[model samples]
Target: MFESIKRDLSFIQGLLEGDVNHQHHVEYRGLSRLVDVVDLLVESVEQLERRLSELEEYVETIDEDLNELELLCYDDDEEDDEWDHEIEVTCPECGEDVTIDEDDLDDENVELLCPKCHTVLDLEEIDEEDVETVISED
Candidate 1:
């Protein structure tokens, strides 16, 4: 790719200096038309590079998200894999739902408090119905 880019740049510079050859008349009009063609190629190459860069960034983001998701709690104890593992953030005292995820239950000892009512809810506090609803939306 770098070699190709360098060759294109060299071609552009040659065109700019009007050192390129043509079969017919060697007029400025013909060179100008050829420059326009090069300009289009350069613009297209730039656009493709930008798109590839964006795709790379998207892949990186997905990788990071996957890393975070892997840390989510998986159930091997009382509950089955399908519905046993989940994270729950809620008002512990009031039972109001806040944020829920599979990672919430990763550690049973951890307790998260709700911002609304200041209630402490742990991974066990989260309900299966809440998990079902949240998973459906995701």
Candidate 2:
């Protein structure tokens, strides 16, 4: 199972390093191959878990192996942050958070007027960690 993963890693590395600009086919093909590798690994792990119920030590070893494989896929320098954060002004009249698309705004102190309330409210910087919590109660 690990051998298959190694091969898939090589495949992904090649695509990442190669000239991705000219070839669109390589992108789709590589992604599909990586997906297949993950699916196969998951199925094998399920079987391994069932068969090794008696030995806790063996299970721990398998778990470590899987964890290491997952870490290999992580790119430390890649800007993988989807939510490129920003400062959001509040609408004084409506009390709603007024945010702008990251592309349009410059990184500096500026007065941003809220279109919702037509109120130019001051904004504090927000980070990714400052996520709004939503709880659904039954």
Candidate 3:
């Protein structure tokens, strides 16, 4: 599209250049001014086309980056879904195994009181792999 416009502008510049040198003094002056204006307009349009192309490439890059960011942010549902509702842990105080529901867990660190002997258990202190092993075995 831009190439077509540039070709048309070049044709007009050639015609104006010829008309500017004609013998009619008054008409020649008007044609000369028109030629200068046309040249400036063509140069401005070319610059605009260049800038628009750059902007298009920039927008495409941003779109790709946003797609990657979306995958990183929300693509872990499968991994998260592997864990079951209940997590089994061994109480350190009473040495009794206990099953706790994941839904009952709070946001902050809290005690997992064992029902067998009322032993206070710190869930974070237990290795996650051990808990996963027990849960998976069950």
Candidate 2, 18-125: lDDT as tens digits: 756645676666775676677677678867876778578788999999998777666542334433544354465686776664533454566667676777654444
What's the distance in Å from true for residue 99, model 3?
20
Q: Write the per-residue lDDT of candidate 1 for residues 1-138, one digit (tens) a residue.
A: 646865876776566566445535556567667767776777788889999999999999999998776655333422354453334444547766665556656767667677778766655545665544344221
Maximum-TM-score candidate: 3
What tens digits encode model 3's per-residue C-alpha lDDT throughout 1-104? 65776687678667756664574687767766776776678789889989999999999999999999888876786556676567777777776878877664
lDDT of 1: 0.63
- What is the alpha-carbon RMSD of candidate 3 to the true structure? 7.5
Q: Candidate 1 clashing pairs?
A: 87-101, 87-104, 87-105, 92-119, 92-120
lDDT for residue 115 in candidate 1, whole number 0-100: 74
Q: Which parts of model 3 have CA positions greater than 4 angstroms off?
A: 1-24, 77-138
Selected candidate, larger lDDT, 1 vs 3: 3
Provide the clashing-pair count of each candidate structure: 5, 0, 0
Worst 10 residues of 1 by lDDT: 73-82
